[model samples]
Target: MAGTETHYTLPRPTFDEAPKLLIVVAPYYKDIADDLIAGAKAEIEAAGATWEIVEVPGALEVPTAIRIADRTADFDGYVALGCVIRGETTHYETVCNDSSRALSTLGLAGLCIGNGILTVENRDQAVVRAAVDQQNKGGGAAAAALHLIALGRKWTGGEKQVGFRPVGA
Candidate 1:
């Protein structure tokens, strides 16, 4: 049972400047979404970071929102929160695969993103995972974004100069 499983969690990363993050959530399941938001908010605050929240219509839109924010917003990182409970239709698979892929693509493009979307067998699983006191997938996602932000700051040797310059000084 997942409930009985134990896993090691990394200590929260510290930041010289408090990171600003945007939390994009799809509230298809209102209660679940609320729980997820709560967990994510708590985690962000605990790390001494600040965050803002935005709601999209569904899971498929979560990545798009993040991408737009990355381009036009001054956020240091992003946290994606949503719940996709498997249904009788194949739409579940589509949402799960497409959303995950899009988020991965954004991450590969250098956007610091934390994917907290819950793809589960049913609402029961989502409830358990989203609960702030339980798995807290939301918090886990926030933690992921924080870690990536730390790595980016650590390795960023200032902006690389593009194009050519004059020969020698």
Candidate 2:
């Protein structure tokens, strides 16, 4: 089974200047959400970064909160956490696809984001993936954000101008 296979993880990254992050979570499943939050927080702290958290109503709102924070807050990166289990209707697919697309769009727009939202077929799957000692997808998401933040710092001051400049004498 996939669970029994070995996988490679990148070495934990560090930063010269402490980074500030925002964690946005949807607590539809409170227990699952709590577990994800714990794992993400642990990883962020271990990387010597500080984080703030906000809870949204559901998975669809997680990205919106991140975008709001990105626009008006000073966080260096964001971690999105939630759990969406398949239901009898098609709502599950909509939530999964839209939330993911929104986050991806923000990421492409140069906002450092780690997407930890879990879309699973059942509660059992969500439990396994959310466990800190198991899949630990939350930690994985935090790591992703950290890595992107590191890259952003590395390229900061080295960016080339791309468009028109103000008229000079």
Backbone clashes for every candidate come to: 0, 0
After superposition, which runs of candidate 1 have C-alpha atoms over 4 Å from their true positions? 158-169
Write the residue-wise lDDT of candidate 1 on 1-169 in tens digits. 9977999999999999999999999999999999999999999999999999999999999999998998898999999999999999999999999999999999998899999999999889999999999999999999999999999999898767779998993
**What TM-score, over all chains together, does every model reach?**
0.93, 0.95
lDDT of 1: 0.95
What shift in Å separates residue 22 of candidate 1 from its native position after superposition?
A: 0.1
Over the stretch 71-151, how does candidate 2's per-residue lDDT look in tens digits? 898999999999999999999999999999999999998999999999999999999889999999899899899999999
